[model samples]
Every structure is written in structure tokens, then in C-alpha cells.
Target: MKEIRFENVCKSYGKTEVVKNLNLTIKEGERLILLGPSGCGKSTTLRMIAGLEDITSGSLYMGDKRVNELPSGKRNVGMVFQNYALYPHMNVIQNITYGLKVQKFPKDEINLRTDAALGMLQLKGYENRLPKDLSGGQRQRVALARAVVKQSDYFLLDEPLSNLDAQLRVSARKELVKIHELYKQTFVYVTHDQVEAMTVGDRIALMYQGHLQMVDTPENVYNRPANIFTAKFIGSPPMNVIDMAFDNSNDSAYLAGQEIPLQEEWRNYIRQTGVKELAFGIRPEHITLSKTQLKNGLKGFVKYVENHGSSYGVYIDLEGNEIIAMSESNKWPPKEAIYVEPRLDKMHVFDKQTTNSIGYPTSIR
Candidate 1:
């Protein structure tokens, strides 16, 4: 396995810049995932690393060797594409052995690698089956076995599970994780599904508008987003962002004219943002509800209920605005009156102007 590095990498199409001055490093044996919506350049980055796309500028290195000038074959990288690019006529064993044969390896070496890969992918008995005869997930495994036979130091998976059904995708994901664990190769995966990234990746690079927003662990990305875009993108139902104004003299923050006591950490973040008009954020899970109005919480009317099995999504209408909250219990409160309270410690404060998080200070812990 080898470390992959992108130094000020830039990719352009005529006048439009699709990837801009990206600097990232994938350490040896790390499972790194690039996540973003289509047109965000996540796939482009993966293709560039695989040497499928030419680097417009800057350098890319695998371990200590510069690979930008090398072709895909010379880059010592294995890639599994979204479509499971397997030969339709070739059986699984043929596809897996094709790479080793081309490399002119000894017959014994070819058999050794192919057998090991097929066994790891749990395709030991289906080696004689053609791609057309195999299930979608099995075909994908055949494609993966082909790549593994190459025995490259780096692996690039570009939405490798996108073609499979949801149930098959789950099984395929588990197999892929097992492969990664067994091989311990440097893995770079690209996908638009945040759930896939969160579950399978060791670290996630959250991208947007052709730029890297944040590279962090799943927990950090969800709990402490770098910006508003990330804050809304990572969560299931997402955080509720409302316009909040702070009164410095009163040492209080107002959410829809309700005076809520600001914790010292939040107060510090407010001072750091230095803006009067800030956005207050709270996750759906962080908000609690009751049939009767509480003393410290805010009052709002129940707008709607969505049953999501084992939990209920409650939307509250406060002053013509909708604030959504999730409750583990599906029991509904009265439509006319429902009190909602936010756990202040779980709140997030961001700068209104820059849209960046002004996080709570460490001393407040």
C-alpha cells in the first residue's frame, strides 16, 4: 500500500474549472471517501487519481513517485467502476485471470492470486459462471476480483455499488469492507450517498461546488460542520436553522422573540462571530416535546406528523415557519398546542455573514 497525495491539483474544461486547487492526502492503507452531489467533481478527482483523466496542473504522487505523467496501466492502481465493467462473454475465472496473463506472470502465480481474491469475495464456487449468469452483486464481485488480481498498491472505487439494488448494495458494502480489511490497501471511494460514505469510509471528504468543504471523521462532520452547507447536508432530517438576534446588554438570545438563556460557550461563539443577525441550529433529535407547555421551552402548534417506523417526524408551525423535530415515540401531541424545547448544550451557532460555525470554546466543557 502507498500514500496518495494531490498537490494543488486543478482540472478545467475549456473555461470552466471543475476541480480547483485541491490539496489532499490519502495515507497508506486508509479508506478515504469523497462525497458530494453530481457535478461537484468527486468522480473527477477519482478519475484523475486512476490516471483516466489528465491533470490540468499540479502534481499527483503515489508514495514517493510522481504519477501524473504515467498512464493508467503504469500507475499501479486498481479501479472498480460504477457499471461493473466485466467482460460479458468471459467467465469469472477468465476475467480474474486476464490481468495476470497480460502481465505474463507464471501460471502458478496467476492461480494463487485469482484463487485468493475469489475466496475473499466469497465467489469460490462461481468461478466458472459468466457475468450474465451471475447476480448483480456477484458480477460486481467478479469485477472486484479482476482488479484485485492486478495486486496494485492503491484501489479506486467510483460508486461501485450504485448499480446494485438496495439489499444487494448492503451485502456488497459488507463484502467491500471485508476486502479492504483483508487487503489493507489504500482505498479511494467516490459517491454522492452520505450514508455510504459515513458507514464505509475511515475519513470523509465532503465536497461542494468543485471545492473540498471538510475532510473529517463521520462523527466530527455530523456534529461539528465547518459551514452551513455541511450542517444541512450531513444529517438525516437536517438541523433546523432559524434567524436569531442577540441582545448584548440583556445577555440573552432571541428565537422568534422568545428569550432563551445563552450558555457561556454559546455566548463566546456569539462574540466571536461579531454579528447581530446569526443563525441558530438544532438537530431534530436534540429537540424535545410535551403536550403541555414547559417553563423554559418555546410554544408552537403541531403542523404535521410523518410516521417513519419506530420514530415520528413532528413539524411545528411557529409564526408561519416550520421547525421539524423527531421523537422516538409515534404518539402525537394536540394540533392546537405543542411545546418544544431545545437542549441548549446541543445547539450550534454560526456566523450569519460567513456562514461558518463559531463553535463553543473548550473552557465551556
Candidate 2:
């Protein structure tokens, strides 16, 4: 296993810069996920690490050795793409051992590697089957098996599970996690899927507009987002952000026309920071909804309801701003107006102008 570090790394094509001043250190044997929307330069950053794209400036290191000029083959990194990328003409065994054979590995060593990969990825029974004969999931496993047999120091995956069905993708994610645990190789995965990033990554590197937004553990990225973008991007239904005003003289905050209750610590922070206008945010799961009005709760009319398996998302419109709250009961479109109350400890406060988090000085929990 080798640690990968980027020091002021930048990538561009002519005049357009896709990656800008990236400085990140990926620990050895850690699964780091590059997560963001399209055109955010995640795949481009991965390509640069794999030596598929040249770094426009700065340096990239693989455990102390600078690899800015290294070829992809010499980098000893295994890669799997979204499109399977398996040879349709070759059988499973042949496909898995192709790289080893090209590297002129000994017959016994090749057999040993292939057999281990096949067993690890549960593809032993389909060794003789061609790519055309296998299912989509099986084909994906074969692609993974091929990469595993290489036994490279770094494993780079670019949306490898994107093509699989929902159920298959879940299983594949588990298998990938298990493979990483067993192999202990440095993994750099790229995807726009938030679920995948939250599930499979040890640390998530969120990027936007060629800039690194935040790099932290999945839990941290979700619970203690650095800014409004991080908070909004990481959640499922996304966080509900509402513009609010704070009165320093009374040490009170109000949303729309209703007063918002804040914990003592939060009130103190806001008073010390002297912030007047703020963007208050809370996750849907953290907000509780009630048919009857609750004390110190914001009331809104039910706009719609979205069923999510066991839970229902109740969308409520308070004034002109919309907020969603998760409900366990099957209350589809409440006849009466609903009341929404965000947990005082769970509320996030961001600067209205800068859109940066100022809720808690440190991460909550």
C-alpha cells in the first residue's frame, strides 16, 4: 500500500482549467472517494493520478516518489471503468490473466493470482464463459477480478457500479468494501452518487467547479458540513435552508415570521459572531412533523408527500420557503396544516452572505 499526495496539483486543457490547486493526501490502504456533480473534475483528477492525464502544474507523489512523469503502466495501478471494459472474445480466466501474461509473469504465479482473484470475486464457476454469456453483474465482477489479479499498489475505480441494477449495485458495493479490507490497497474511487460515497468511502473529497469543496469522513461530511454546498450536496432530499434574521439585542432568531428556538451555546456563538442575517438549515430526518401545532414550532401548509419505502417525506411550505420533514405514519397530504420543528441541537446556521457554516464551533458528536 502507498499513500498518494497532491501538492498544488492543477490540470487544464488549453485555456479551460478542470482541476485547480488541489492539495490532498490519501492515506495508504484508505478508500478515498471523489464525489461531485458532472464537470466537477473528479474523473479528471483520478485520470491525473493514474497518469492518464498530465498535471499542468505542481506535483503528485506516490509514497515519497514523484510520479508526475510516470506512465500508467509503470504506475502499477489497477483501474476499472464504468463500461466493464472486458474483452468480449476472451473467456473469464483469459480476461483476468491477460495483464499478467502481458507482463510475462511465470505460469505458476499467473495461475495462483487468477485462481485467488476468481475465488475472491466469486467468479470461479464462470471461468470458461465469455463476456457475452454473463449477466451485467457477473461481467462487472469479471472486470474487478481482472484488476484484482494485477495486485497493484493502487486501485482506481471510475463509476464501476453505475451500470448495475439497484440491487446489484448494493451487493457490488459490499463486495468492493470487502475486497479493499482484504487487499489493503489504496483505493481512489470517483462517482456522482452520494449513497455510494457515503457507504463505501472512508473519506469523501467533494469538488465543485474545479475546486475542492471539502475532504472529510462520510459522517463528518454529512453531519458537520463545512458550508452550504457541502450540507446541500451530501443529503438525500438535501437540507432545507431558510433565510432568517437574528436580533442581537434580544439574542433571538426568527424564520419567516416565526421565532426559532436556539440552544444556549448556539445563541452565545451567534451573539459573539455578531451575525444579523443567517441561513438556517436542518435535515428532513431531523425535523419532526405534527398535525397539531407544537410549542415553538413553525407552521406550514402541506404541499405534497413523497413515499420512501418505510418513511414518508412531507413537504411543507412556510410562507414562500419549502421544508421537508420525515414522518413514519402514512399521513399522505395532511388535511390540516402541519407544524415542523427542527431539533435545537441539530440545526445548522450558515452566514447569509458567505453561505458558510457557523452553527457549531466544532463538529456535533
Tens-digit lDDT track for model 1 on 188-252?
99999888998999999988988999999988898888888889988888888887889777668
Best by lDDT: 2
Candidate 1 weakest ten by summed lDDT = 356-365
Which ranges of candidate 1 are over 4 A from the true structure?
Answer: 333-335
Query: Which pairs clash (backbone N, Cα, C closer than 3 Å) in model 2?
Result: none
What is the clash count of model 2? Answer: 0
Task: Give each model's whole-structure lDDT.
Answer: 0.87, 0.91
- Candidate 2, which ten residues in sequence have the lowest lDDT sum? 356-365
**TM-score, per-candidate, Cα-based:** 0.95, 0.96
lDDT tens digits by residue: candidate 2, 273-307? 87667899889999888778888788888888889
Give the best candidate by TM-score: 2
Judged by whole-model lDDT over C-alpha atoms, candidate 1 comes out at: 0.87
